[model samples]
Target chain A: MNKRELIRRTAIEIIAEEGYYNTKVQIIAEQAEIAVGTVYNYFSNKEEILNYIFKVEFDKRLDILKRLKVEAISFKEKLNLFLEEHFQELETNPATTSVLVQESQLPRKHSLKAVDDFINELPELLAEMIESAKKKKEIRDVNSSLIANAIFYTIRGMASKVVLNEHYNFDQTKEELMNLLWCGIKN
Target chain B: MNKRELIRRTAIEIIAEEGYYNTKVQIIAEQAEIAVGTVYNYFSNKEEILNYIFKVEFDKRLDILKRLKVEAISFKEKLNLFLEEHFQELETNPATTSVLVQESQLPRKHSLKAVDDFINELPELLAEMIESAKKKKEIRDVNSSLIANAIFYTIRGMASKVVLNEHYNFDQTKEELMNLLWCGIKN
Candidate 1:
């Protein structure tokens, strides 16, 4: 891996292992087998490291929705694809998931803004999906933003549970949750 | 009001103005027009003050739900009452709502535990509602805990939105959300 990639991966590991507070710059440098000065060359500081990790993960998940085949798809299929892709990632990357869940807990100012920006984009997408579904007369005429938020929150909340619940199989929960959302939205 | 009540109210105002951290015990005591030591007799610490506020608000909302005639009501009515009550509280008490939202963001053990406990009860309560609805044959057979969670997350997500979009009339949105949930669960 390149210097920047190494720094980023190592940073995720440290933060995952020790959390935000205990993961220090010097420690990250040692873990990554790079000098503290080399760490500074690639990124500004710990916050920047965190911001980059969040953006990378956020973009990766957001792309799943954006790149899906939107034309001639059932709403059930659309939702299934959304939840499965999102939850699978959480299962694979528990560290990143934990960070996303707890990152907002910090007293930082920008985390909410970042999360809000992520949330704001969902409604327009849902509106498009709803418009198409309405043309098919598949569901009731409803406020798309509200529907979008409902779906978003359902998955988000379930994702949190998946992260925290060690004994529960999220795959099963995801299937059940997808069924509920589909049953709720479909005509 | 008594000193204890005064401190609780003052703490709410202070938290509303300066956020959870910025609003200190000293500031609350000052606003309550009492000595800082006097505040101690009423609250063991800031966290205790917050817990008290949460229990009071949560129980008050629960009491409202308990008193409603859900037993004799239609499933739609039962769900509508549940959604509207939550939306109305989110509108009326944005300050407490704000604190609760922020608390969910905290990485501290206590904050995480408190949020978990708050959400844990919801699934059981919702499961009860869903069970009743199913026996009435108001909806299809589904996993009550799973469906209840889906419904709960939807409401929680919308409530968070109400807090963020202060001027947005959540009543209409809430109506739409309830309708969606109702549609999803119905035969």
Candidate 2:
């Protein structure tokens, strides 16, 4: 791994182990097996490191969505693929999931611009997919932005459950979520 | 307002103005025009006060739902009433909404039990409504808990948007949300 990736992975592990407030840059530097100054060279402060972690994860999702856009697949297929990948990402890295969920709840202080951009980007991508679906007649006419927000929040709620509830059956929950989104609660 | 109510309202205002971490019990006492000792006489500490803010707000919601249960209305009507009231509450008290949302995101160091109870109770109440709707054939049979959780998260997303975006039209958003929930997204 490059120095930046090395620092980010180390920061995630440390923040996950010790809550973000308790984590310090020095601790991350030690964990990454680098000098504190070297860590600073990569990230100005601890918050930047946290921001970078989110950016990296978000970028991965965005990349998948971008590729899915070119593939010969239905919007439902794209959404299902996205949800599966999202849940799988969290399931594999429970600690990163915890940090992401927890940090998001805190006040927006450090790297506010980066954080805001990342937050906006997710919904924007989802909205684009919804628009694509609408144009292709895969879905009924609706406010794509609102629907996108609803789907985004549902995914978030699922992720929180995955982290907070140890007994949470991810596969079952994912199946139920897909069924609910595709079919909804209408009789 | 009673002394308890006075303190609770004051705490909400203060916490909303300056986030939960920045808020101190003494500041709350001062704002309420009560002695710090008197504040403690009613509550243990700052966290309890924060918990009380959530409990008070949640209790109001629960009470409304309980009453809605006996009313001669369809399940859809009850759900709409609940969402309308929920959105109105946030619109009227944006500050308290801010405190509630921000504090919920923070690490659970204080009043974990109270926080957990509040979180669980909301989805539980929504689940109850879904169950009622299903039994009455007002809505199709689906997993009540999952549906309830989805509704709960959607409302949360809306609340966050209301706080973040000044131009957000509450009535329109509420209308769109009901329509989405009532009719599936399928073409």
Candidate 3:
């Protein structure tokens, strides 16, 4: 892997275990097998490195959603595919999920710029898709941004559990969530 | 209000405006119109004070949920009544909701014990209700704990918005959410 990519992956692991406040640039450099000076070349400070992590992750999801928007599949198919990708990514990289869910909740002084952007933009992106779905009568007229936000939190709450708990089965989690999103729990 | 309640109210306001790390006991004491030592007499430390806030808030909701369990109402009615109370509380006391949602998300060093309990216990409480509802066949075969967690996050996400925005109508917000929750967005 490239030096910058190596540093990024190393930081995720250390930050996941030690947390952002406890993590140091020197430790990340040593763990990545690079000089601290070289680390500084890629990231201005620890916060910058952390922000880079969120920016990369959020951007990946946004790209996938954007790509799905143009596909011939129904909005339901799009959502299912996106959720599958998102959850599987979290399931495989629990460390990154842990860091993403946790660090984004820090107070402003410690909060990352990208984290704030994700908080604002990810829902908007989803809302856009929901809006289009409503227009096509693919889904009922549920408020777009509101439903988007609900879905966002549901994923976060579930992903947080996936990182800490082992009992969550993949198909089960997705099916239950999809049921609530598509057909409410009202018997 | 009593002296202890005065301190709690003042602390919530200050902590809401300034992030938790930025708020000090002395400031809370000054704002509460009490002596610093007097504040200590009631609470051991700032963390304890924060924990008390979460403990009281979580217990209030738990009480309502427990009370609802014994009522003759269906799980659907029980959930609606509980959500109305929960959202109305947040709407009226935006400051408290702001603190509860934001503070509970802080890292371990800064995390409050009661916040942890609220996060862990609230979902379980809801799961118990869902489990009982399932037994009665009042709801579908959806996983109890899974739906409970989903509802928990959905509330958190929506409550997070209520604190920051003023455009959300009480009826609109509740209706949209109850619709997605009671009867999902499927056309």
Candidate 4:
């Protein structure tokens, strides 16, 4: 891997192992097998590294969601694919999931606005999905942004549960959850 | 107020205003008009103050929930009443909610095990509600603990959205969400 990429990956590993407060720049540099100055060359400070990690993870998740495709066009199929893809990614990367879920508990001394800005872009992306689903008569006609926010929170809630409830096996219930999302909790 | 009560209340006010890290023991003592050492007499340190505040808020919420009389009622009514109680408390004490939510994110340099323990008790309380709902034929006969976890997350997600989303109105969606929970998403 490139030097910059090595630094970033090492930062995530250290943060995961020792947490943000305990993991210093020097520690990360040593762990990454680079000079401390070299680490500072790429990133200004520790907070920046944390923010970069967060953005990368967030962007990666969104990219996965964006790349979700359906060869045969059915709204149900599309939605199921989306759910499966999202959950599978989360299940495989529990460390990333842990960080994402717990990151909010981190101090607000840094640029949360950047994260907020990234999240703001989601409603529009969801608007397109909602418009298509509406045309397909898959979901009820509602305010796209509102529905989008609900959908986002629902998935977020599910992820939070997976992280917090250690013994809660998500695999068995994954299909049921996707089905519930499509058909809803209605009888 | 007594010296201890004054310090505790002032701590909440300061922490709420300036956040935990910014709000120090000296500042809290100044706000409470108590001696700095007097604050120590009441609590060991800043961490103790936080634990005290959490215990106070935790008991307050549980007290409200405990007052809910569910005997001889249909499961639907029981569940509705539980949610109504929760909403009413959360709406009334916005400051406490902020503290409670943010406190969970604070660095665990102190004994925060109490907080997790409190959360651990939720499944038991929720499982009882779920069983009652099942007996009343109000919800699907799924695993009570699983359903409880889902309900817990659903409320937390909705609550977070209410806090973060400026355009989203919880009041308007409250009824619809309740209906969704009661009736599921099926047509």
Between prediction 1 and prediction 2, the one with superior DockQ is: 1
Q: Can you write out model 1's per-residue Cα lDDT over B87-137, one digit (the tens) per residue? A: 778778877777766665543644633355667875667788788878879
Residue pairs in clash, model 2: none
| DockQ for every prediction shown | 0.58, 0.38, 0.57, 0.32
Off by over 4 Å in 2: A21-27, A70-72, A104-114, A184-187, B14-31, B70-72, B104-114, B135-137, B184-187
Ten contiguous residues minimizing lDDT sum, candidate 1 chain B: B105-114
Error of 3 at A26 (Å): 0.9
User: Per-residue CA lDDT of candidate 3, range A3-116, in tens?
Assistant: 878988999999999888889999999998889999999999988888898899989888888899889998888888988998888778878887886664454646677877
Candidate 2 lDDT by residue in tens digits, B51-170: 788888888888888888778998878878988898888778888888867754565544356557757888888788788778877787777786777777777776777577665677
Residue range B1-97, candidate 3, lDDT tens digits: 9888888889899989997888999999999888999999999888888888888898989889889989998888888898898888877887888
Candidates 2 and 4: which is better by lDDT? 2
Q: Which ten residues in a row have the lowest lDDT in candidate 2 chain B?
A: B103-112
lDDT of 2: 0.77
TM-score of chain A of each: 0.88, 0.91, 0.89, 0.85
For A134-158, candidate 4 gives per-residue lDDT tens digits of 7667776555665555556566666
> Which parts of model 1 are misplaced by more than 4 Å?
A69-72, A109-113, B65-70, B104-109, B112-114
User: Which ranges of candidate 3 are over 4 A from the true structure?
Assistant: A104-108, A185-187, B104-107, B184-187
**Who wins the DockQ comparison?**
1
By lDDT, the better pick of 1 and 4 is 1
Interface RMSD of each: 2.4, 3.5, 3.2, 3.6
